[model samples]
Target chain A: MREVEPKLLKPLVAGFQLEKTLTKYIVSQHNFLYCQKAADLDASVGKTTFTLLRQINELQKILNQKIMLYRDRFSEADVYAVYCEHPDYEGLNDGTFVDRIEDMCELSTKCAIKEWNKSQIRNEAKQACFLFRERRKWLEIYKTIHNETKTVWLAQRHH
Target chain B: MSMPTIPPEPHRPNRKEVIIDLLESIALEEIALSHILNAESEKIQAFVGECLNFPTKPSSKEIIKFNKGVTQLLESVVMKEWILLRKLENVLDFEDDCEPHHKKCESRCHCSPCHSCHFPVCKCRCSHKKHKDHDCYPGK
Candidate 1:
């Protein structure tokens, strides 16, 4: 099922080329009703979906490359002008992006640290900020806990 | 009368060294984290895309199978993310958690390219280190 590529199904149905996996998957669609030509493919729902996915992926890749080229032709000022034009981008604050996270420190400590450990190369500045922020948060919380408990604990020990 | 002498203390780094060590550790941790997040995101995205494919109008049974695949992937992904979060928490030790906070200007730091802690020139021992005075070569 995972191996099925709808693009290859066209050739298989046309009797042009017979790949075993494509034939098996396509035939499984509807009792192996053979496609007369590429035009006949529309009637088969399964085959059409796979073909469209492949087509869309190719188009997206090409479009992305062209976009990069387009940006390359423009100056930084031109790019900034386009960036500022968007209504949603009020300014480049943290609010400019969504903050789905609750605790930045917790996210940094657990998931980020594990990922960082596994990574072969690193971006030091980014890492430094992450680490510093996590520590800052910890210190903030630790102070709060320390102040609340210090008097009670000291009294109990004296008694 | 001569006062009793106390033995000289062993070499110990100051607050500035402590800050540098922590910063370096943290930066390294973040780099590792970014990599994992990227890898997991890619994996989950691919799974969702696969689920979006429905060849011909799917029969009830086929729909069920498709939904099952998606549900399984989501469940696993959720667990993975949760596990990663927990791992991050553990990595940041709460033990001996306190450090003496020194108010220093972090402004000049983002100013320099060589990234050799351009925070204010302190009276710390690190000032004596040769690299501090010289122009640092960029790469290792």
Candidate 2:
């Protein structure tokens, strides 16, 4: 049997690592925008929401471009595996996976905003404060995922 | 004669510029995530295939099929995220009639001729032309 050459393995591993990084980055961004949008909605109705939503939209565009770039860099096979292993993938149909996350992220953002508004009107300072802190938590999770995946990639390469 | 004092301009940040910066950061994150996911999956599959080969080597076709399933799963996830990002972009278009600034910027500003001029300087030049206001390069 012919051995799988180290040369072939190197690129393959590298490609997968790239895909993982892209996915986590995107998810984190989505979460960040979601929280920001929520906070904006809670604070005011018109320009603030519009501004945050607009920012979210812009982030989405960048995300799209990055996705295309990564797709071009790696093979379909590499992309697929990453999707399968993602925690968010569970209970999501393959066709609707992206839409689901996008929708949920947007909805969550709006919800956060609504909650913020409610707390403000009711003067529930603690709840309002929690919303801000929760968003930061999501960001931290994103960073953790990114760091762990990077460490894994390094280990594979060296080993 | 005493000179009249002029009030400083308000320090409001441009909404569009803020959006662009946030988007760039998100895009970078997406690239990093994809890189890690793809690499990890490949590593796992390779290790599994090697282990299975201990007693009797699996046929190339069998290994390929197994690998294909794994790859498909990952691709689907990535695609889903891509679609979400696209939808968000669509929703965020503030100036409904305006062309996406990024696309226009890439073409008109990044080229060698435009590079000679700084971004704001080039944008000022482009805005004077027949181009739509949205398409005009953002002035620094």
Report the lDDT tens digits of candidate 1 across residue range A1-159. Answer: 112222212211211111111112222221211111112322232322223223222322322332233234333333233222332222212321112111222222323234543231123223423433442343243334322442335324433
**TM-score of chain A in every predicted structure:** 0.26, 0.33
TM-score of chain A of 1: 0.26
lDDT of 2 by residue, A87-147 (tens): 3432222323244234433444445355554433233223322432343343343334433
Instruction: State the iRMSD of every prediction, in order shown.
Output: 18.9, 17.7
lDDT of 1 at A54: 32
TM-score of 2: 0.24
Q: Indicate the residue-level lDDT of A116 in model 1.
A: 40
Give the Cα error of residue A71 in candidate 2, in Å: 17
Per-residue alpha-carbon lDDT of model 1 for B1-140, expressed as tens digits? Answer: 99998778797666445434543453344334334434443443333333333335445454445434433443443344344334323332321122111233333332222224433333222434544564332221
Which regions of candidate 2 deviate over 4 angstroms?
Answer: A1-159, B1-13, B49-76, B84-88, B95-140
